[model samples]
Target: MNFSLVREMMRKDLQEVRKNGYVFYSLLLLPIMLVVISVIDSFAIALSSSGKASMLLPTFSTILVFIPAIITSLIGSTSVILEKNNHSLEPLLATPITDSELFAGKALAPLSIGILLSWLAFTLYMAIMDVLTYGHLGYFLFPTELTLVQMFFLAPVTGMLGTFLTLLVSSKMKDVRAAQQVSALVVLPLLLLIFLPIIASGSDLLINLLAGVGFLIAALAIFFVSVKAFRRETILISWGK
Candidate 1:
C-alpha cells in the first residue's frame, strides 16, 4: 500500500470538501436539527400529559444513519463528477498509480466524512442524553451500546456506497444536473424505509438491516464497474465540451 499516496489523496480530498459549502452545511444541519429536536422533545415530554415521549427514540436513531448518506452523496459524487467531466481524470490516470489505488484514494473523502459525522453524532447524542437525563443517561437508554456501534460501522459503509454509486453515474454522464438527479434517486428507497413503517404502524429491524446489506452489495458492484470503466482514453473522449 502507498501510505504517502493515500495521505496525499486524503488531504487533497478534504481540501476539496471544504470548498463545497452546501455539502458541509447539509451535513451540519442533520446534527443541529437532531440536537434541537431532541432538546425540544425532551422538554415537551416532560411537560405534556401524554405518555408518547418514548416513541421519538426510533426516529432519532434512524437519523444517525440517514444523515451521513445524504451529505456524503452530495459532496463526494460532486467532486468525482467534476474531475471526470472536466477532463482532469485523464491526467490523474496518466500517473503511475494502479486503478485500485486510485479508487481507494478517491473513496477516502466520503468514507472519512461519513465516519466522522457518525462519531460526532454519537457524541452529541451522548452529551444530550446526559443533560436530558440529569446524568442518568445509562438508565434510560439501556442497550444503546449495540445500537451506537451499529451506527458507527454502518454510516461510513452507507456513505461510501452512495458516493461510489453516484460516481458511477457521474462518470458516464455528460450533464452534471442529470447525474445529480439520477444519483439522488438512490435515497428514495431509504426514505421509504424510514417512513413507510411509521405510517403502517409497525417497523422491523430485520427488514432495515437486510436493506442495508443489499445496498452494500450493490455499492461494491458499482465501484468495481466504475473502476473498470474509468480508463484515461474513455474519460478524455467523453468529458465536458
Candidate 2:
C-alpha cells in the first residue's frame, strides 16, 4: 500500500544481502557463467555448422530464465533469517506498515534482482548470438518469440512466485539453512524448462505463450494468498517457540 515504505524495505533488504559478500557475489556468478558457456557452445557450433546458433537459443533461454528463479529463492530464503539473526525482524515487523506493504517490500527485492539478472543474461546472450550468427548468415537470429516470452514474461512471473512463496515460508522458520532447503523446491518444477530446446528448435510461440500466461496467473494467485495468510506473529513466534 505504501510505496515509499516498500521501497525503503527493499533497500534495507538489499543492503543486508550485500553484507554477506559470498552469497551476494554468488548471485552474480550464475548469469556470468551461463553467458560464458552459451558463447562457447554457440561458437563451437558456428565453427562446425556454419553459424546457425538458432538451435542453441532455447536451451540457453531456458537456462538464462532460471538465473532469476534461483536468485529469487536465494534472496527470499535469506531475508528473514538475516533479519532475525541481526535482531531486526521484530522491529521490522513492528514498523507502521500494513501486511500488504510489508509483504511487497519483502517480495520486491528478490523479484527485482531476479528480473535484472535474467535480463542481463538475455541481453548478453542475444548479443553474442547475433554476432556469431551474423558472421555467417549475414543476419541476426535472435529475439525469437520463445526467447522473448521466456525472458520477459515467464522469468519474471517465476521469480514473483518463487519470492512470494519462499519469503512466506521462510518467515515461519528460524533456520536459514532449512529455509533455503525448503524454498529450493520452488525451482524444481521449473527444471522442465530445460527441455524447451526440443520445442524451441521449432520456434514454438504457441507453447511459450501458453506457459507465460499460465505462470502469470499462478504468480498472482500465490502472491495474494501469501499476503492474506501473512501474520507478523508467525515471523517471530513460529512453532510456538
Candidate 3:
C-alpha cells in the first residue's frame, strides 16, 4: 500500500532479474534482433519492389511494436507464473503491500524493460534506415512524426497492459502451462496486426489513429477492472486450491 514500499519492491525485483544471466542476456539480445529484422526487411523491400522508400519506411517501422509485445507476453508472463508456481505469492501478499502495489511492482519491471527495449530497437532501426537512405541521421526520420511518436509512446502502454493482464490471468489460472497458452493467445491479435497485409502495404494514418484511440479506451477499461476486481480475496477465490 505504501508508495515507498512499492517502489522498493519494484527496484529489487528488477535488480534480481538483471542479476540473472539469462534474463540479462535475453534483454540485450531482444533489441538487437528487432534491429536486425527491421533492417533486413527494409533493405529487402527496398530492393525488391518498385515502391518509393517513403512508402516502405512506415511498414518497416511498424515491426517495432511487436518487439515489446513479444517480450512482455513471453518473458513477462512466464516469470509471473513461475513465481506463483514456486509459492512466492503468499509471502508477497503477506506484506503490507496492497494488491495494487504488489501488482504494480510485479508489472513495472517487465513493462519498463520491454518498453525501453522496444523504443531502443525502434530508434536503432530508424537510425540505420536513415543512414542508408539519406547518408545522415537526425532526431526525426519520417515525414509526419506521428507513427514514430506513437510507437514510442503507445507501444509501451500496450506492453504494460498486456503484461499486467497476463499476470492477472495467470494468478487466476494456477496452471502454468495453461497460463502460458492463454498468454500466447493474448498476442495473437497483435501478431495479426503485424502480419496483416493491409498494414504492410503502407501505414494507414486513419487506421493508426483509430487503433490508438481504441487502445486508450481499452486501457482505461482494464484499469477500472484491475482496480475494482483485482484483489487477494478475488485471486484466492478464483484460483486457490
Candidate 1 per-residue lDDT, tens place, 48-163, comes to 72345444343455556655666655665566557766667767778776666666677777667776877677667656655665443235642264345447555665676666
Q: Which has the greatest lDDT?
A: 2
TM-score of 2: 0.86
Candidate order by lDDT, decreasing, is 2, 3, 1
Model 2 weakest 10-residue run by lDDT: 190-199
lDDT of 3 by residue, 1-241 (tens): 5778878877877787889898788777978987898788887776666346566666767667666666776666666456556678778778788878877777777777888888788778777777776632223455346556557655765675677666756665756677778778855465455335535445776666666566667656765575555677755445534
Best by TM-score: 2
Candidate 2, superposed: residue stretches over 4 Å from native: 48-59, 185-202, 239-241
Q: What number of clashing residue pairs does each candidate have, in the order they appear? A: 0, 0, 2
After TM-score superposition, the amount by which residue 173's alpha carbon in candidate 3 deviates from its true location, in angstroms, is: 1.1
| Model 3 misplaced stretches (Cα beyond 4 Å) | 49-51, 135-144, 190-201, 234-241
Off by over 4 Å in 1: 1-4, 19-27, 38-58, 84-88, 135-143, 185-212
Residue-wise C-alpha lDDT for candidate 2, range 125-177, written one tens digit per residue: 88888877777777678877778887888788778767876776776666877
